[model samples]
Target chain A: MKDWEKNIRIVEPYVPGEQPNFPEMIKLNTNENPYPPSPRVQKAKEELSIDILRLYPDPTSNLLVEELANYYGRKKEQVFVGVGSDDVLSVAFLTFLNSKKPILFPDITYSFYSVWADLYRIPYERPAVDENFQINKEDYYKENGGIIFANPNAPTSISVDLEFIEDILEHNQDVIVIVDEAYIDFGGISANSLIDRYENLLVVQTFSKSRSMAGMRIGFAMGNERLIKAMNDVKYSINSYTMNQPSLYLGVEAIKDEDYFRENINKIIFTRENTKNSLEKLGFDVLDSKTNFLFISHSQYKAEDIFAELRENKIFVRHFNLPRISNYLRVTVGTDAEMECFIRSIEEFLLKRA
Target chain B: MKDWEKNIRIVEPYVPGEQPNFPEMIKLNTNENPYPPSPRVQKAKEELSIDILRLYPDPTSNLLVEELANYYGRKKEQVFVGVGSDDVLSVAFLTFLNSKKPILFPDITYSFYSVWADLYRIPYERPAVDENFQINKEDYYKENGGIIFANPNAPTSISVDLEFIEDILEHNQDVIVIVDEAYIDFGGISANSLIDRYENLLVVQTFSKSRSMAGMRIGFAMGNERLIKAMNDVKYSINSYTMNQPSLYLGVEAIKDEDYFRENINKIIFTRENTKNSLEKLGFDVLDSKTNFLFISHSQYKAEDIFAELRENKIFVRHFNLPRISNYLRVTVGTDAEMECFIRSIEEFLLKRA
Candidate 1:
């Protein structure tokens, strides 16, 4: 206990959801898309000649950057790619959130925001999400080092309008504002279109949810040239080869297949609405969810009991043990059939408890 | 033009070697394996079902960890894998190199060492390598936060024996010592066998050089369980899913093929010896190389000139403009035929100079 481990880093690390390999398990945790990647991604994998892996990937991820820039109608200098949205946000935190003042975010947003602020020793303030799980725009107007939040906030499954986001950006002219739009493709309006007007805005999106490439780990940020340059400096300093050859190749293919991407997005949105109606019928208070997941809590049935019961029935959903959200369950909208089974499981659990 | 970008990260980032996508070029700039990956890696790629792209990769890289643990005869707790060795070293810098004192490494070791130290604001000192391109064990015995050096160091292509490495580890009981063995399989002895003896020692290796998976971006560190735990904490704090699914699946396949690995390593070693001899016959002062590359300088010809001439002939070699190694050319040992072509091209350039 008294060895050289004293100076080493020690933190209560962020725990990811369980990735059980059982075949019969219904996994609704971690907010992954229930659809496979495009046929082009499969084609890319099929045509991949293994000989090319002997060399290193392009350090700048130029091709992927070009594709992302073209997709968003931004210049190549405005796009920066990373291993995932986590990587993009982590690097962004290090690059833009370094002022002496404390940065600001919603308390009930992505749990990783505070973890990242702590890891980088960047001072931060998490103003509380209101009782209805909405971020009050005035709280972000105060002085801060920088500002970052998921567009459709995690766990709460709520989306803030772009006009309010622009108000925050307009107030905080001297600081960077990162809009982590990880779930923006799932019916939420993107802050990317505001990049030209707001030089400090960085809109990060991931292929994990919308394009069904969570296993590939590709995400990117679109912002002003100067901000993207700062991010690149930090990224190249950290790891030049953040994205691998296969991920880069498949990412391009995935981006090109717009029809397949939209089809899955529509399916997820449709199921989310149906799931919301079904949960309401089951006496659950479902939040207004714009994401691929729905946050719900039943007044009679404790979320802890339901989570346990669902696990026993081989149905898994995320239940946070954190304060103020312990009673709520963030359920990823799976296939229509999976949601039906999930609803049935919840009904059985409630009946047994009654 | 003045904005919030002033306090942001402004590092003079490390520039990696060129990755020109030319079909006719013999690329010997970066130290890539001349041979392809194992046939099993190809099989893994071919048999990979695209359906799994819907789910996130195992955050802990459990199966790949198991394969690497089994291969190195270490426990799973002792192995920490990352996107690349740069990511591993960067995380290790954050984890173990947190003391008040400055960490120590050779002045001309891996260039990324200084970049990482600067990126994280970790204090570091670079002691000069001896005239024979060797690391003196006594230089690292001083008071420091940590120690790291590439075995068979990059661009210099010289290696220090394990006893010297052990001597530094033995002397520095209170600090972490990282022996980056990126090129160890090219005849240099690995300090991995000494992991059981020294709890303070951390051995970092990569699939880039030895296993021919540079495009896949896989690397790992083997050390004490306590240190690995600390690293995992920092890694989890930074980004949980660093390695992608394809990298994880194929990395396991690459590790299971020991014969394919050994055969390619032997081939690179053989070509290295032959290349060194050939360079010497052309009046170049070749450093005794233990890696897949040969570091040579010619008294009659400047390295910059040769680098340009080689590029004109569709041959690329690394030429550093840094202080100590300004006149040197770090030539990656390519296939026998590529080396022959390289030799003939060098001869033609010298003949033209005459």
Candidate 2:
């Protein structure tokens, strides 16, 4: 490598989830929605011609922000939008965490949080989640710098109760607390309700999971106007023009079609329950999931072997290369048909190994 | 307000140009293209519907990056795309300015540079451009942590020579030097020629100007693989998925359709040349412009009053409130027919005041 800038040389890059290029594989990775976005999304894009591409998108993303505000029942000032939940969290790290104090987060949560901390040179502490992988409310009551964690934490899919989250907010009034609800809408409650009560709390959510618009790269933050104003300041200083025009329209349409979203939620919930039950019947232990995916490991079969066997049979699932979660396979709940195919293939792979 | 993190407590917000609500105003406040983007942009959007919106965008923006590489004859690994050039520049600041030394930029260049410095708490020095507001080649050759400036410099539209820029890069061995070519495709000499010679040289361009895909929110950097990799590391740590799918299609199409781009660019260039000549005829001092806009002022008329008169007559051009530029107005060149109307309106405004 070249003798790069000291900061660039120092940064440790974050690896995103596997986007396998095996065209014929039955992909169950990346936690994308199996169902398509609202029909209105396609209709909106079809209706919006490429010619509008000549003009710059609204620097503020004002329209989508207002629509999101109405969706969450908050004032327009309380809402902010960005490229994705990852982007929102990254900016939040910059806006709230720096030299003045060390930031705090769960040790077993999303891996990108620590990456952002390192990239910005922000000091942060990982208060370990309990043995059951739950963020301890008591651990966060004392002052640090800022706080953030993924709800229904990744790999484990276990959610912390909202009351416990609120208690932490009430106790830690001096710091900025962020709740990342990337997978919340699958079957969990949103902390959006707590926005009006807490001025220092910034709850970030993504359209990628629930709205089935991950391809559009839209995520938002809801909080007291002061915190939002700070994020907006950071956003403007970076890219006044953040969201693309098509995503802007698609995001607005995705939130407006409540019936489509509610239907998709029910479908995923049903599939997740059925899939968990089926895996258990096959001697696998599955985490109690409130997300679109299952955190599972078979007592008789190795997680890596099952992961490999499925891949050999053209059925793709996720396996992290990390230490804590390496024993579990995170399988995204796909359509009923895709899930059926996955189960049958897994049964065959396990039977062959036996 | 609340006891928040101290880093952002003193952060101030940026004010964009006036997006006034007057229904009948001939809007020219921001330097947006007078004409719409190619019909192909709409065609691409219409072709992809709501179904595609459900999926997540390719996290790396692979297709667009490859297309840019092929077009520029550079390695795909050497380019990094972002939501906008503003986003690209911000990432650059985060990646490069953390060097042991502080960044050096023109005092009167893009206003947002200082805002980013303040936001990130980056130490910087504002080296003044020469009396004519031209970037002094010798001034930039001195020691610097990093260096960046908009070529054909904004508001002044005074293009810098290629050799002087080369001289600066020749001297700064350990530092990253950036050329923000926001208005480059209009007519300024590209610093891209020096990119192959210097590993530290980065030339950032936007679809907002040359490609006319401003609304789509795409900008990128052209540098060697190491620098691009560093920028991508910052992007991934901040926001893994910066571009959405539909905007990806728009960018691909915009770059491929060089005929459409050439036709529009030529027209804007012609309009700029004509406008500059006409203003000179009216006894106004006009900066030598190599962009789609003109910067002009008269010795007699007050710049603010002239700006006010134009607004009253429904012809809006940008007039900065800053000290050095308060005397001049920056006007974006429009279509031939639109420019004809604008000149007539301005002629009337100037004569009536005379």
The prediction achieving the highest TM-score against the true structure is 1
Question: Tens-digit lDDT track for model 1 on B1-354?
Answer: 567665677889677667887878999999999999999999999998999987899999999999999999999999999998989989999888888899999988888999998988889999998887788788888888888889988879888888898789889888888999999988899898999989988999999999999999999999989889889988999889989999999999999999999999999888888888888999999988888999999998999999999999999999889988999999999999999999999999999999
Every candidate's TM-score, chain A alone: 0.98, 0.96
Candidate 1 at residue A167, lDDT?
92
lDDT of 1: 0.91
* Native A-B interface contacts kept, per candidate: 0.89, 0.80
- Candidate 2 C-alpha lDDT tens digits along A71-185: 8899999998998888888878878776457788888878888898888778888888776677787888776888887887886888877888888888888888889999999
lDDT of 2 at A284: 90
- Name the fnat for model 2: 0.80
Give per-residue CA lDDT, model 1, range A212-255, as digits (tens).
99999998999999999889989999999989999989999999
Q: Give the Cα-based TM-score of candidate 2 against the true structure.
A: 0.97
Model 2 stretches with alpha carbons more than 4 Å out = A1-9, B5-9, B21-24
Score each candidate by Cα lDDT. Answer: 0.91, 0.82
